[model samples]
Target chain A: MEILTQIFSLETLSSTLRMATPLAIAAIGGLYSERSGIINIALEGLMLAGAFIAVVVSYFTGIPWLGLLGALVFGGLFAMIHAVVSIKYHADQVVSGVAINMLAAGGTVFMLNIIFNTSGTSESVNALPYWGPFKPTVYIGLLVVFIAHYVLFKTPFGLRVRSVGEHPHAADSVGIDVEKIRYICVGISGILAGLAGAHLSLGVLDSFREGMTAGRGFIALAAMIFGKWTPFGALGASLLFGFSQAVQIRLQGLGIPTEFVQMIPYIFTIIALAGVIGKSTPPTAIGEPFEKGKR
Target chain B: MGVDKIDIKELAIELLIPLLAIIFSFIIGAIIVYTFGYDPIETYAALLQGAFGNLNRFADTLLAATPLIFTGLAVAFAFRCGLFNIGGEGQLLVGGLAAAWVGTFDGLSVVVHVPLAVLAAAIAGAIWIAIPAVLKAFLGVHEVITTIMMNYIAYAMVAYLSLKVLANPGEIKTPPIEASAYLWRFSNILDIRSYMNLGFILALLVLLFIYYLLWKTTIGYEIRAVGINPDAAEYGGISAPKNIILAMLISGALAGLGGAERTLGLYHYYIQGFSPGYGFTGIAVALLGRNHPFGILLAGILFGALSNGRTFMNMAAGVPIDLVNIIQAIIIFFVAADLIFRQFIPNKSEGGVA
Candidate 1:
């Protein structure tokens, strides 16, 4: 009973929510891009860029919100690069994504070493002002999730986006701007992912670390799939993953083997992904770049 | 198409694109280095010297290329079969662990023990990818998403086992393999004290085997057919699902063998960071090689040289190792955009894709 009590404690609940927040935000970002027929594997890299830029700007400006804004702008810009290479230039989506990841990883490390004279980490910067013991930003994330869901499912623009993902050629024949929709969707993905990164640096840790986003973007991708690409479903999946991570941390505190505990979330993710694999379907045109002339 | 006629013009055009891409990327790298107050020419010269300056350094380059050849081949094999096996890292980890397990156990003769360990690693790798294969084949799931997810799972599992269950009682690594199972290293003659070993030969054999398997067999034909057009393959009576699973299994086995080589030959024990992103780098290598076996071999060696030389470049010319990474990224970007350059250059054959 005591063990159960500890497991179900308020601290555990809050920590779980906190851990899930970044993943939830990133998953929502993934949902937008993927639903619109673009596979945004670069979310991880984008988030890292956001986190780094947020810290750098915040460090210089001494305002956390500005840091957040900076991240959002840069993240969007990075996504634009993806849009140009994939949507305009007709580059392979997967390869373009890989390029972005490599660029982000190498670029951030390079910038860190050159500008900050550090490796794998940056100096602690002034964090965004916390709203309370529980930050108001968490609520903002939830609100954005709901808003994004509403926009994706209920709006006319959402329908067009969905159509483009299902069959761009058909969508084009029907007079929908396939390229435009993809550009917007990808751009939105960047903004949301950037916010997630900003939250990591300014809200969670108040500093940037190299590879801090680690595989969280991939985890969010998994959550998006496990959630079947629906916004609410993605949230549920993110919470589940977050809960696993929270449990791992708690178990670590109890002197349980930390390594085994660390494996729990990843193991659960793999199992869940495998189980959901054949059953769930991604958007039809997920990886295929939209070529204007091709049938 | 006349096989006898050599179209020099077409060949030159084809060469133009890759050449321009390389030149463009180099220019970008030079600018970045110049921004840092470093001379690009001197830095690159130093890089060359460090990578191939001496026989010892050249050996080191080959050593680094050894496992990469396997991993790159593994990735390219899957690509040819129309599956994306991003789980190479995970497969490698499991395979490494299996080989380590077999190696630490004493009793068997060298001939039997070594082969057994290698087979176990291959089996372990095959099993690792089997789940995703089943998902993709039966449920219509994409391998890209599933394989990526599995990579994390594999990493975590390895970390868990290495830190607790499989870890040596007093160390963070597993027990070293028995002498009988150990791979023969040629460091004694090289006098360089580097870890390069006979695994390079094994890597070469695997590459040749992959070339034969992919191009010389009926199964290879079916796999390639499925990759080009799965529906056509299915219509022609080739089971797409079976082929998918088989390809993944083969790819995983190769990756597993790569891992085993690293453990039994070089490291002598399993440890964290054993790979250092070899799995991801393999993706770049496979792409640069254009998914051809011979191309993969050349690309693998080039990457190995760059990686080995980066350290030397850092020490000799004070050029940051990050520059090499930038160059690598550029190479991948250009290769991925190879078609873009194709428009400019008509067709000229380069040595190989890499």
Candidate 2:
């Protein structure tokens, strides 16, 4: 009973919201790419790049908002490389994503060495301001989720994205410009994933550390899958994972193995994919390149 | 005879593309180095010197390449069956734990104990991948997501077991394995002071075994047939699901052997975060090698050199070690999308990207 109260306390709930913001935002980012028929496992890299960029910009300019803007712009440009490789060159999407991740992992540290002469971390920067109990990025995260839900399900652009994912040839027959839609969708994912990264560096903490995202980008991918690729579903899934993380943090001193607690979200993701929560299918042509005039 | 000529020509192209990719990546890496105000020639010279300046340094390079050969082969073996096995890291970790556990057994002969520990590692790795393989084969779940998820689970499980259940008092690592389980180091035969072990030989043997198995066996034929076209292979009476499971099991075992090599041969105990993304580096190796057995061997060696020599580059040339990783990523990009090379080739024959 005591544990139950501790788990559901106001502080824990607020922590849950804070923890879920990045996952929800990143999941929405993944939803955009996967829904447009591109398998983007590069969210981790994009988020890392964003976190690094946010810290660097904030450290230089002394404005957290401007840092967030820098992250978004750079993240999109970084993702465009994946876009060009996978879409134009017809590379395997997963392999391309792996390369993108490696680039970010190496590039960030390389830049850190050059810019700060430190290999492990950056200088602390001004963090994003909080409004009420939560940071503004948290509110922006929620707003992005609702907007993603509307834009993905209710708009003509959403219809075209969905069609391109389902059957690019059919969408191409109708002059929907399948390749262009995929490029834009992948770009949008990069932007949102960048926002998630900024939230981590500028919202949750004040500086970027080496590999600090620590597979949260991957957790977001799991959330995107667990949510069945819907924005609202992703939000719900993120909250569940966030709740687990919150509970884990609160339970740290109570002799519970923290490693097992950490395993909860990932193990749940595997179980979710194994169909315990009903069948979750990806976009029909999710990993395939949009080849024009081909069967 | 004509078919043989065509086969040789095809093999030449297969080899040429990867070679081209490596060269292009180096050129790009050089440009990046120059842009960063470093001397690219000096940086690369230092890298080569550090990797092979002496017998001792060359041995260190081989020691670094040892586990990579296993992981590269693991990835390549699964790619042959049209399955992407990205769970190598998880499998490797569990394998290390299993080896650590088995190596603690009391009073066995060196030969018996060593083989037993290695077998345990391989079996543990195979078991680690079983869930992902089953999910992928039977439920239509993509192995990429499942395997990656399993990696996190493995990380947690290994950390819990090593730190909580197996660690010696007040230390972050498991108890050292019995001396009987240790893989003999080359220092026994050579004057080198490095930790290079019989594991390098083991890696070469496994490489040869994989080559023979994939090209000379009925199992390899079916695996390749399925990889080429599962639907067509199914129509031709091969069981796609069964082959998928078998291939993944073997792949996992290979990755597990990599872990065993590190534990019994190098560390003699399961250490936390022992690997610096060797499993992930295996992906780059497999791609840069074009998924061929011999090619994987060379690619693994190249990456191993980069990893081993980066320290010298950092110390001598004032270049960051992370540049190796950037070059590695660029290599993968060029290799995966060979169309980037098509721009440079005049009147290239048309085919899908390999």
Candidate 3:
């Protein structure tokens, strides 16, 4: 009972929320892109770019919101590389994403040396002010979730995005531009991933570190998958993973093995994907390039 | 049979595309280098010298290429069957752990112990992938998600086992295997002062085996048939589900063998994070090689040289090692979307951006 209370404390819940914020933000962004029929595996790269850019900008300007703006521009521009190659050039979606990740991991560190004259990490920078128990970005992330749910399900734009994902040819027959919708959704994904990255560097912890996202973007992908590509589903799934991460952190002082503790969320992910939850189908037209006048 | 006519034009184009991608990437790299106030020529020259200047350096390059050859073949084999295998890292861990665990056993003959350990490693890797394969073939679940998740799980599991069950008293790593379980080193026969080992030969034999299996056999035909059109292959009485599992098993085995080579031939123990993303690099190698066995071999050697020479480039030119990374990524991006450049080249034979 004592252990359960300690595990279920308000502080732990808050930390869980804090951890889930970035994941939820990133996953919701992915939900848009994936639901719009383009795979957004470059979220990891975008988030890393956001984190790096946020730090550098905030370090210079001393204002967190301005840093957030930098993340959006840089992240959006970085994601356009994937967008152009995948949507415009008809490159393999998976390969484009993998390339983005490799680029982000390497490019961020390379920039670290060029700009900061340091490798592996950046110096301490001015951090975002927290409001009460949470950072402002945390609240913004949750707000975005609600807004995304509305935009994805309640609006005509949402219906078009859904229709585009379900059947691009059918959508095209109805006069919707599939490529334009994909480009916009992917761009939005970059923006949200940027926000998520900024929260990591400015909100959760001060300064920047190489590969600071640390598979959170991948975890966000898993959350997106686990949530069945729905915004609310993404929220619930993120919390579940967030809870496991919370537990892992809590278990550090115990005699239990750290590796086993860390395995909780990943093992849970595999089980959920395999069949603990019902089968989650992807968008029908997802991962296929939009070609005009083709069958 | 008459000697096949060497179409030098076709050959030139085949080689020229990748060469152009490399040169383009280097140009971009040079811009980045110049921005950082470093000379690109000096950096590249240092890289070449470090990778191939001496016999010892060449041996190091081969030693580095050994594991890449295994993982590259792993990815290429699966690609031939139209499967996306992002789980090589996980498969490698299971195989390495199995090999390490088996190698702990003493009082065995060299032949018996070594083969036993390697076989265990292969089987372990196959079993690890069997889960994703079953899920993919039967449940229609994409292997990408399952395999990526499994990679994290495998990392955690290995870390746990290595610390709790397999660790030597003071070390963070597993106990070293018996000398009998060690692979025969090439340096022994060559009398070279390098770490080159029999793993290189093993990688070559596996490469040949994959080539034969994918081309000469009925199974290969069926796998390729399914890859081209699953519905048609099914209509022709091929079991798509079975081939999926079979291909994943073979791919997993190859990746696992890579792990075993690193453990038994190089480290002689299972160390944490032993791979250094060889499994991920396999994807780039396989794609750049166009999924052919010989192509994968050449791509693997090229990447091996890049990795082996990055340190010299860093030390001599005062450039960061991440330049290799940027170049690698640019290469993949260009290869994946070569139509970006193919448009400029007047190739009447090619279609626009398919």
- Name the best candidate (by lDDT): 2
Q: Highest TM-score: give the candidate number.
A: 2
Q: Of models 1 and 2, which has the larger DockQ?
A: 2
Report the C-alpha lDDT of model 3 over B1-354, residue by residue, as the tens digit: 111246765567667767777789889989989888999899999989888878888888888888888888888888877888888888898899899989889999998998899988889888888988998888777787788777888888888888778996667889989998898887787756767788888899989988898888999888877777778889999999999889989989998998888888888999987887788788888878878789888988988888888889999998888988888899888888877766666655555332
lDDT of 3 at A68: 88
Error of 2 at A122 (Å): 1.2
Better candidate number, 2 or 3, judged by DockQ = 2
Error of 2 at B319 (Å): 0.9
Ranking by lDDT: 2, 3, 1
Judge candidate 3 at residue B270 and give its lDDT: 95
Model 1 lDDT tens row, A210-295 = 88998888878878877888899888888888887888766777788665655555555555655644455688888887776576
**DockQ each:** 0.52, 0.87, 0.74
lDDT (tens digit, per residue) of candidate 2 on B24-46: 89999999999999999999999
Pairwise lDDT winner, candidates 2 and 3: 2
Error of 3 at B135 (Å): 0.9
Ranking by TM-score: 2, 3, 1
lDDT string, candidate 3, A85-130, tens digits: 9998888888889889989988999889888888878988888897
Docking class of 1: medium
